[model samples]
Target chain A: MKHLDRREFLATSAAGIGAAALAGSFPALASAADAPSFRPEKDAKLDLLRWTAFVPSDQTIWDENTKKFTAATGVPVSIQSLAWGDIAPKAALAAQVGSGPDIIMGWNDDPFVYPDKLVDMTDLVDNMGKAHGGWYDNARSYCYDQDVKRWVSLPVGCTGNAVNYRKSWVKEAGFGEFPKDLDGMLKLARVLKKNGHPTGFALGHAVGDANSWTHWILWAYGGKQANPDNSIAINSAETVNALEYARQLSETMIEGVAGWDDSSNNKAFAGGRIGMTMNGISIWYNGKKDTPDIFPDFANVTPPMGPVKTHTVSNNFTSAFVFKYSKFPNAAKEYLRFMLDKPQADRWVTEMKGYVTPALKAYAELPIWTSDPNITPYRDALASAKYDGYNGKPGKAAAQALDEYVIVDMFADVCVNKMAAKDAVRKAETRLQTIYKRA
Target chain B: MTSRSPLLARLDSPRVLGYLLITPAAIILLGLLAYPLLLGIWLSLTNATIGKPGEFVGLQNYATIFADPIFRGAALFSIFYTVCAEFGKLILGLALALLLNQQFRGYRASRALMLLPWVAPTVLSALAWLWLLDPQFSAISWLLIRLHLIHSNIDFLGSGWGARFSLIVVNIWRGLPYFAIGYLAGLQSISKDLYEAAAIDGADGWQAFRRITWPLLLPITTILVAFSSIFTLTDFQLIWTITHGGPTDATQVFTTLAYQRAISGGQLGEGAAIAVSPIVFMVVLAVFVVRSVREK
Candidate 1:
């Protein structure tokens, strides 16, 4: 057998890796520039891959705008839409394999996970800063890459999780308005349950769905998850009361609500089964096509305070990053600039209707943005919104290790089932401690 | 005396050639299948999460699986689902096969349609079931409610019993065709002469079937039972597509739990551990099946 020399093979592979690294494709540097659709001799080609579904709200409207932008400047654009969950693996693999898309959208929270894979857009943010009035703090915080002292994924829509209620149901329940606080919510839930409209914070197995629960409830009760110091403050009196309130709410809920995941709740609400729910308005927007009866005269409000504080949490808003594999960094910045521009951003806000809130402040001045009733509340909420993990260490492993859904379930076991709240909290806390310690 | 070198070399020569011919197959097995299996076994003892390589933590994953209420519940639920589902399939498939085997006009055409449910993709079947099982739009439940068989619409996938019962129905539906086809093959293999001999011995149709038909089908029965047990125990696709071990993890099986640990919770090591424990049970069942069948 002819054996290969280990030293030579290692040396050759290292060199190849180094050469690939310096090539600076994905996870390296520079963004891709858009080119003419039909290869024009004068223009350069660029690709834009977004970690968001290019829905009617932003991408389509941008396509119309891109036509005009192309009319003036003869470069072409290609847009790739993907789910946010698929972004990192795609980006990472594209980097490793040397064939990733040029410009990809990521949530502001994404830089923490893959900072090296993106260009430091701090200069881009600073450069683009004058053109835009301001950025939402929560959305902007996640885009900054502290490692390189620059911004990464440029902020787009700013969303805060809120309670979406049916105006028709509130009136039928003998309530003049949406429940303003925890007590009001409790009272309204009991009223609604008695009146045939059961209410609940629909629970199920989805991990991101669990985060929405954590932010609106856990944070309200002072459950601090900021690490390297995870204090299981979720076991306090305020939290116990929150859990108790959750339990009482559970009692007033429809029988099958415990099994409802996000889509299931959306179906429940759309069918007028659930009186209200806590989740993203994206579901509400997307549901209209299939379930039009579901979206009528609905009111979106800041998640009500639980006798403590009404805090908002969103898993993330749509975000983008210039991949290291980019062929044209300058072109990517230009596209991001165009994305933030007036009729473009406003059209996204208007067309997406209520699905997204524009990251740029001045878009609120635009006609379509201001005129939309369903979308306006989200704009107001983001003014005071704190991103669930904005600016913090990714702390994903720690938080995951804690397994918030399972923890919340355990807590709910005590709170709703009257399984001894202290015992439940203690078990959950011990679990949290073990997770945090391991992390 | 034979020359030592010539004799020794000849002993090795043909074996080396045989190994050489099988080299590609061996390499592929090692690289693709065997390595992953061994790696999974290794991972089961460790505390590996996704993306992060983990430290070995002895039998902690197995211990935790037993200690966790969720796993214990899932295990019992899985066993209940498997036993009920397999038996239901066996009974239904056998009955269906018997009916199809009877001489009748248009029986050949109807026999072909029976294979559709078995052959249809699990995802498509699940989607069909999802529609039929929806509380508001469920065709079956709606019919039952309309006919006053049930007072109100029952949430078929909500309650534990409802979900388990629903799984039994689906599992039976999916597995019936295999059993039916297997029984048909077994039935066809039986010589008509034996039945003729039984009839000549003053045996009635029922008595002939009991003595001649049942004994002949024994070997096939053992094979079918063993095959169905393994297949049913390892079943994941249909139930996952239907409920994803849903509403309360009420439909939790070992596979679903393993999936949650691996994908949802990102606990690969724990999942690998959970995934493998079922094999021990399956192996024991398989051995018992083979041993009993062999003794007969």
Candidate 2:
């Protein structure tokens, strides 16, 4: 830290030279150019960069409702389907290069990680708060910096981990109800393995899995990363227990569990190699629609209780960001506000089925969502889920530590039998402190 | 400046044309290499960002990297990987070159086939290896299983050792062909009369190769080894596609670490520092190699 002075001297000298050049040109360009102000292209024309899995067709839709969304919303979602994992880096890169999707559908942590790189919607939040009948308060808070007083993103959807089971398999295993505790769950797991039902999990080195496993166990032990102060406090007895239990679970984990990333796990759950795993309603929704026979008799419920409480990591709570470069701040906010409206959100969830459960109360409270079995638990889990540390603008170092480094290498190190639970946590903690300090 | 006169005129005739010929390369190098190098050195002393240019922070970035465990691990791992890769490429490539230089059946076809690995784009080769290393669908794993060479399938990219081993093998495979071709070309350029003269003096094939061929090829080897060291030191794709420097810091090279630090960590200054650290050594090694080869 002490070295900053000398470095600042040399750097500032050069920056001053560059700044002179930039200042000389920028004001001239701004004044002469036509971009003094321009509104976003908001003609009720919504643009969505959909995930690859969400794009369905050519297989014949058995449901008539989806056909109607296409027909009615002639807003015909210019659906560009990208692999979900590719969304962040691609979006981040595009945002860096100054041309990205008007509306990119991604996972939860993006808004926090890319907040400054996004549009602030305080006015939109106000207008849409009333416009959308006041979105679920928790969802709204997750999408913004409540303390900073800005709506960094609009909560479009929500996802949460749950006890997804092959209802038929559990019935045959002589289990009447889902496992309520760790011991019961292990006993059932053993019975299932003995009966030739192999449990599989996808612990791939992806950001989704990073959050997924953290939430799976953190909530399992009734622990949270943030205290009331929102500081990292994950290292605790409960977290350690979850770590040990996660390792033990790794032993009984099937032969090819490591090979299967997100897709493989979805396939395992659907194809019957795995009876029950913790996942979002999207797993079931995707399965039921794509591979109907593999869907099986299903159920979604709370995950097993640790000594603390039974909770699942809340998911699907994505925050929408407006980049600082957006020519139309009002229009961008307007577009986000439109997505917040109950009818639009309801139509989205209703059409997409249970994949993206809406975060807006107006949308969640709709009769369509209230009646859906798969989406209901997402609503319930939102009450207790914890968020990782990204203050709406996730940095590269923090991003690497969380997404590329920590989860795959550390958590999976224990989860896949490479290292002891305690050692992995210790190693990760040491590395994390250094990385976080730099941040 | 006027000392040479007419003698310098003839040499200077080609000099003007040579500069013209190399001008494009110089410009490209300046933009891609020189500018980036200067930019990195500049940024390492500051907190320059993608979205915002931050205030300068001096040598703190370098100090922070030294203090950090992950950076240390990655740095150490990079040295290990580079050493292993360079040795593997040299030894295996030389042995293959020796074998291929022999008079054999389909000699031209065999010689032509050696160029395949060197010619393939790195990204494609890495992608292919990813498939072959796939635990579930790995053709190699399937063959190994059938031959009873192993137990169940191994997750080549899942464990630290497995991931590192996979990268080394892929790099060796890609590196060997180029090495062999370079050696083979060097072999062809050598005068056959030396070998004949040695044979007339009662030298066997081994002695002829050792005394004559190896000595003459020293120049080539010096150049080859140094060039490969530079290439291997900065390699980003092979490690990226194979392990992404993963399963931990096992396969993380300096270049990959620099990228992860910059783009993913958003510590552009730190990343720039890490990226440029290699240049100090790289420049020294390159100079040494050029001088050593020239002297030979």
Candidate 3:
């Protein structure tokens, strides 16, 4: 080779190296080219407030990804995790005060509550949707603002809810597999109770567990909290039917479940006090990590079909929204984009081990779903799930209904108080009407 | 001494000095107590949610909440909880205080140990009670079962009445130490001569307690009750930790309901209304306490 000038030699070497790297990993390079949704601001440091992770790996993997983002973009980030229930109040207070964490990972319809205070993520979301397999329907319902026609938040993954049961106990109850219909499941519950292996579901003000199962039961029976026209519809015959079904189901469950909180079922199931309960992957994951004998004997299945169709709800449906007050909105958006990118998103979903179902559709093809039979059912949670305040908008009214435990109380009224189903429906309708009417 | 400036001389006046002396306290009261209380009242009068600067809607929030059965239920429960808890704390606390007032071994140690429940963080103690009240694994339930007193687990938090009772019991447990220690202080100040005189006049133990101990202790008891009633009426932590106002809202109180509505439900105005509704009752109690103190 000829002896080139210093500038010429450096230029030639840089071009050759770049070409080789791109060719060797073309897809990675292509994704990298599309990575930054916005340029990082000068001296950008970010603070993110997120709910404490239910799965330990979720926190670890998220922190690792966050560190990688900082390394790549030279933007520092601090993460603050609080109990899941606390995120809503803190986020609301942050919005009210116009200062706090630059970004908040909020649950359910949190973005809806303060859409005006959030930085619009429509551009990032639309681009991500097209690059990925598009957003899940429930994700849009949660993060999109119809009035403003903007994406107020980026949809994070959801914690899927499934019926975690002891396989041996279910088999002993004369069911080879978990029942797949409402009637069959109720029959199994009765049999399990008789066999001294009672079933349980939260009937108290368990913000997550109670709301998940109660909403599913109501929807499965074709009862809607509000009609699509946004009219109150919870006092219908369908609601009464749902109430009756819930009361029957509660009868076969272990006593005192009516007062159970979010952690109660996990404790009860892990200790073998109950044969089955409706919950997320935590119980099974805990058993797998801590109790080998229990882990092998446990199994999970999607909730049984109801009269209308098979319906369920996830315990956690979260979204990340950047606050308008954030001085580094670009950096915040970029961080979310980096996290949701295929490489990181795929890694997150895989490592989560079915604890979190992906919000984007592309990751549904990840091998993690097929790697374990138990993990497979969670993949469909977002697809099968309906957003809160279904039929109507999952807006402030519905959020109020959910937080007030309206649906849970409706079922509990009949099951625990021995109130007539009609009475329970009427009470719930009055409460819902009060909430929705105000809205 | 050198002649002072007119401003300094004026400031030395009693009224000026009184105002000057109280300025810091007034500022503290305004910043800490008055501001929040006023803001809460103002918010209750408006239709404020979380993010929006809401429009004033007068008593619309109050109207809405008053019409709500849940609010009505909470109001009733708050009173029931306060009355029951105060009564239980008073009886048990007075008994313990009377016993502690006697000259005994480990008197100082026992007095300090009595403060454990009160001094420990409420959340931590409530959590301990939560474990004890667990429907399935409750140590209390297990003991009762082992003794063949019951066939099945007692769902301490599962039933409406059971949850209500459990909450009251926990409240009493935590607050008893405060009442006992307070009454003990009053008991120590009482002249032994009164008891001695009553005994010489043919009074029994109960008679001496009714005549001498009762009259002198009334002021402190009233003050203690006033403080505790407010604390008990507005309690959130122990109940939230234990039941979270569950079993069909049997244990719902104003604070929890307000939290559920305002913060969790995002209806700040309605929540503020629920929160401030109890102010009327609290004011009456405050006035009564002040009058009692003055009379004493």
Candidate 4:
């Protein structure tokens, strides 16, 4: 109230603000005893690196949820978004340099690729599992390392892939409804091709679509990359059969499936050029937004069953890793905790338009799945979904093999290059041996 | 003003001043170029992956890559891509330069417009090309199909030949301007008196171009081709954006293969080995360029 000089005024204001901030934090400090196990360090700051979601709305929801976390807890957060393909290399480089985001989101087997550099998030995993129903088997297999006896990552959700098709076209292709099995699907695809609405899936080096579908086909035909002992098992009769099946299917596909990437099929399906393709729900979500006319014509079904099994691979398993070098491990865990909290999780599911399939079973009941019947198949497909490494654990070797596009290339050799299935399998076997033989 | 200081006198020397002027550039080159180059060479000798500190494995990575079929395929593709793209660019650029060299209306504007493909960022233009060559809804495919020139849509980036052809066409498109502008400068520098003298000597257009223009432009062409070859061989963005060295590794080049091995595959050592393999060819080309430019 007295007449004060400029320096006096500034000093007084600074002290007052500092006191108010300290006072504001007193409740949090006092409630330490009642604090959640994963509470962040006092005044922690965090950096999170994740891939840019295919659905812009999904990213928006993620941003909003992070903002909610920052509002609830005073910890400011910075999010770095990268292209999906760039995420692994960026995360790996960061891990190599030992200087990067506090938390990094990557696909399956990413944590295993740099297990020594990632923090053991066992407590965080146990807490999330206990809080939300329980961890899905696939998620547990992806996150947990038996050798180290620790969870190096927290499995969030998978970007579910299903058969995205033009239902009207399917009906016109001499099929009253979407094909329910592999044989029927192939027959429908042939008819669609004959009618100039060919079904297509990537046969090239698409990390997501091509890899996922190729693996599904391989497993469906009882083909496996390696045995349980990690011995080479790629060159089998089952693998040959799978390749033969894929080659026949490729004959019915668009001319360029051999060179298509993950987005090609999505673009084809959305632009009304292709009859059916395997893709994440974002394709439909995108069609609904940008191409409303084409959107209603689109429908989805669970990936069809093969003779041996009804399994498919989910390429979009979003897993988060807190590096050992992070200055705010507690904060990273706390953020995940807040994100996975039931109410927040439900809102996220709705906001993402069910693009993200829950890793926790309880979140399956979120009304978003039932909101659109087309999206329900994605939820149902979650039951048979497998990560990149199917019969074996998702390890460093699996990550390397997937990144090299070995499986994708193996199929392309048969379908695109006209290599005999036996020869292609032999080549893939040698490549797999080279990859898995390394320590 | 009265007596010069020793330090100032020494600094004022032409040699010292020249070194002083270049010190910043030297430092930048050492830091940005030399250091990384040396680091890459060192990394190639080690068994580096993502996080762990790699131990030296001598020439093991090189040996492994040398034995790899993919590496061999990529090497062959890189050579083919470079030679074909450079040859196409040279021919098209020369034609453009010859046409532009003639006195014509709006020549300046035409010259400026030619730079759009070259001046635009490679990634942006490549994305545009991606849309143009899209297998399903390609504008070019639509045009071709409409004309009944082809039975169905040409899979521009689908098959081995299609992807290779698309890559080369895009490369030529992007690189034509550089060659044209470079050759235009060379063309303008040529004395008009030489053409007049050739005409007086009864040399026809082809003879004049062959005798006068060819000899005069040889040095420039040699340098341009060498440099362009290096650029085309090491090109990553254009190919990475277009095909990602796909269609069964049909379009794989050294740079894309290096990226796949080092970054995507996380075999940093092998990736570096793949990357370093291109240096031998580039070094020979560099020598040729330097020798040609130095010869008067």
Candidate 5:
């Protein structure tokens, strides 16, 4: 104004811009500050343990979002990432010892396994649901314990499984597109095998991929692990049919399908070894980034429908539990609140490139799904995605069965070991009875 | 010097001093090893889950495990894996030790390089083997296929027997260097005069090995085999990392089975029982080994 120095003029302009930015976000800032439920402890610090993201960009997005929380509130958050399989046992040990991180994210039914040791987060759930247009049915079922009337964990997003296939290979195998039904899928698999491009999914103790697909197939064939009352209902004609169908399908798959884990198919597909496998959008994302030449060759379709019905299992449906032993429960809750807020959640969803199917209804309109046709199938799969216990409520028994690979072993017995389907079903039934009949 | 009390003087005596010196180590062992062993035994007897406190079930877990087929299978497989891997390692290690003991070009360098497999971290080496034996994209498979030895990739870690074979091969590969290096040290210690004396007495190569080399290396070999057996019997990381006792529990050894029961299945008591079941066998074997070694 009056021949001001360069430093003075620059500082004045920066202050003016800062004020304008603050004015725009003042309402949100004021509301957060005024809300009694949002109050954090005076010196709250948090330690959160979560599974390491398969996609590198997802981890980047997670780190960036957590930094925003630390910037907003002067609280430092430490995030410990571990392998997916390690999370359950580690969380169990922590609960048993009555000491661990403040918040630990695990698979569905993890809360039921140690509900007594976890803090009831129903208030946080109610608040999030009210703000985000209510939780999805599968999400609610996975996180809520109706008998106890407590939300032991907060329902977060689930990763949807779909058939990631090579478009070129499918065309070469005389299929213009992916199979829409299980019969067509089997034909396609056989043709792919004939064409030197076999299709496969994990048949072994792969906790995520194999379990999800095997359970989906069982449910599709009208076989249920338990009835509505949660009694053992595994040994049935429907289960035998499912196992037989799986064995037929296994013939079309590669020999090593019995040893495949959650990442095996992804690697196979990305390396141009297999024609198709059921997985999340991570494979597509990986191919898109690392193998750009083959990126366009990759495409995704929803899991094929079985003879009786179309049913698929959501591998993602992860949730976070705040232990009762947390010294700073409020801080953990507030951190989760900030992370699940619309803007932050949308950013994470966007960064994940549709790999994370949102649990909230409001996130259905995220631009990532609308912008890419490949991602829309995953978004749609979320609507019909079923939890671990489809007909029965997910509880400690179901969790234990899943962890023990009882269902996976049943399928493997028929497919890999060439055991009779009936015998396999009986084996699974006996195991389930032992688990559910326990006091 | 100031006069000392009888009690202090007694404590300063060499015999008392020895016990006094070992007290710290004894306390450390009790805290780190002995207490955990006792707690594990107690846990094995209870019906503990992960988070809940278990009551005294009085060996019910043990009885249940003994009746379980998977535990039985794992026990049998553990012995098979240990005996087979130890046998392979001993033979290969002896061959390597004898070869390396001879004078040759780059002998020192070759000897050092031979230790790479044993010196490298087990987990890292196991991961490398996992890649090498991967059903798809395995370098070894590629080589074999290229050589027209096989029409397609071998399912090295897919089948039960294939996985067992792969694990034993890896174990032998890792353990051979240790045995070779140990035997080499023993081989070097055998004086040249003894070999010359044997030669002067009309002893051929086989006779020299039988009379002089075998007797001198017996102590080292016995100790090495015993140590290797204990380690191989309780092996977890190699099997866990490669197969995770999978393909229908084919590769399931004692430790992996215990892990599956206790940690993954949340049946801590059952897992502990499976883990401690091998201790009795190991203890008896140890006693037998000690008696045999001492007698010789």
Candidate 6:
């Protein structure tokens, strides 16, 4: 549970710094020297399906990296960027029909949904782990299939969530900085609302924003969807406590947050309607470009500490998985390796302005985290991050509960529907039981 | 010489040619509609998830979904949505049709303008409605506030009932033009002489409409109602684009639920079951309406 301060983080990343040094001296040579090479098939071509990123530079740099890969290796790669919500159905259909883009950069637990259909990336992952410092434990949880004893996917990175608030507004609300604990957050929210600037969080079926903070709050209150044994264990006093807290929190929010999706809060924040919301760095990035007047007034910080006094993990994690049905598997593997290598990943992360936190531990020392003091907190976003299932295994059951927005709805039912906390907990428990039992 | 062959001669026969003439249409229907419908139903009866061919479970998926509160809510909501939207569209469309049928100076232009909602893409229109209903940035809210009608913005999609009502309103708004245009065509086809005849018998406008117009329009109304009911029951895009079935799933319809479970959740069988659950309602409605129209 120890958080590494900036100084300590930099100090502990000696190995990462060494890799950076090598990359600086001979970027091409160092990458080629350490990577486990794959000989692409004759005339191998790859098609990659990726979600459209929130930060514009993420895609621009990503496409540039892919072009670099093609220039280095004689293989041609085509990338298709789809909306965030559409990728899941497309990936599922591709998995079901046994044909699609050779590589899919899918969201959390997507590889778990169709483990058997994905290509085994064990060697590629092991080599990458060694070449970099190592993959984070959370990334391993996402990409590795414990049942199969193989890595079914390679984690690309995660888009971490943080509290984005107007600095001036926080000061006006009688806070020096954003609150760091549950009680303080509630007080700050109340004050902000009184000051005519209420905080808003997505209470709807937002795939990213709602799930991220809701899960964080639930887990922070020591509630979980299931136990280590994967049993339904959500009907607990802790869950009720979480629900009650959410109910109190919702009262301090803008009027329509319950119906808001991922984009709603962003618009609200940029339009100066809400004082605070949890989101990725896209809001700050986009605000800098479009709303320069408001840009200096806002700041980003880590999510508030719950009563448990421990930081809980929450993020919109992403990973890449190649399907077994792919005709050019080696080429796909090579392309992933080429993109995830330090030389390319460093640039992508740096250009993204810390929008995407690296899944590999080695990239923690990337300049993006240090250059901007505002983006410093995001560097540790995945440090304590865990997979979705948390206490249980990450699998279809967990993914289903997530896809159905079980936890988000549990909090929302109490917050927006004004259902009794215990009743909402019972309802969520039943839904989770149905999903887990079915799975 | 070629036509003298027995097969060619048989093809020239009226019965054989009649079958041959309808072959393509039948094949197309079977291929496009029947095949997918059967596949979906078949999938529903299995334990199919994504990527794996599943074993038959024999309606177990149906039992599971029926017991699910979310699915049950979606089922009830779909029915409510269909009935309410259809009635609203029918009544309002009939009114618009009647108004448009009048010989106003700009009747042609007004009719064309009225069709914009239906003619515009559903997704695009729904997106516009999303902005219009936005709790914070809504133009309607701005107008209402400026008019001093309400002191605050209406949280259109914030609560369960609010979201449900908003979705139904949007559905009606988008679908009204279809009903209006169809009823207009039906109204125009009615003879002006019938009204003259009713007047000769001392019938008022309402009485004349009840006696003549209602009877003549009943057939078209039945057909329109049947088609609209089916479309509204299976409605996906408008609700999905607007809410994604949120506010505790107040507006979750069968199509969205099916999509969430089957496509997003990767439980193809369960999703298929949810998708096909509305077949009974649709079929029963269709048959009853068709039979009633035929009898009348």
Candidate 3's C-alpha runs over 4 A off are A1-31, A34-36, B287-296
Instruction: Mark the 10 consecutive residues where model 5 chain A has the least summed lDDT.
Output: A27-36
TM-score of 4: 0.92
Query: Which regions of candidate 4 deviate over 4 angstroms?
Result: A1-35, B1-4, B12-18, B287-296
Against the true structure, whose lDDT is highest? 6
Q: Give the CAPRI rating of model 4.
A: medium
lDDT of 4: 0.83
What is the per-residue lDDT of model 4 for residues A154-246, given as tens digits with 9 covering 90 to 100?
988888888888888888877888877788889999999999998888987787888878988898888888777778788889889889999
Clash count per candidate? 20, 18, 0, 0, 2, 0
Candidate 3, residue A258: CA error in Å? 1.0
Cα lDDT of candidate 3 equals 0.86
Q: Of the candidates numbered 2 and 4, which has the greater TM-score value?
A: 4
lDDT of 6 by residue, B1-296 (tens): 34388988998899999999999999999999999999999999999999877989998999999889899999999999998999899999999999999998999999999999989999999999999999899998999999999999999999989899999999999999999999999999999999999899999989998899878999889979999999899999999999999978888999999999998888889999999999998998789878977888
Name every residue pair that clashes in candidate 6: none
As a TM-score, model 3 comes out at 0.94
Predicted complex 6: CAPRI docking category: medium
Interface RMSD, candidates in the order listed: 4.6, 3.4, 0.8, 1.3, 1.4, 0.7
TM-score-better candidate, 2 vs 5: 5
Model 2: CAPRI class: incorrect
TM-score of chain B of each: 0.89, 0.86, 0.95, 0.93, 0.94, 0.96
lDDT string for model 6 (A1-67, tens) is: 1111324323433444466566663233245535665656678899999999788888899988888
TM-score of 6: 0.95
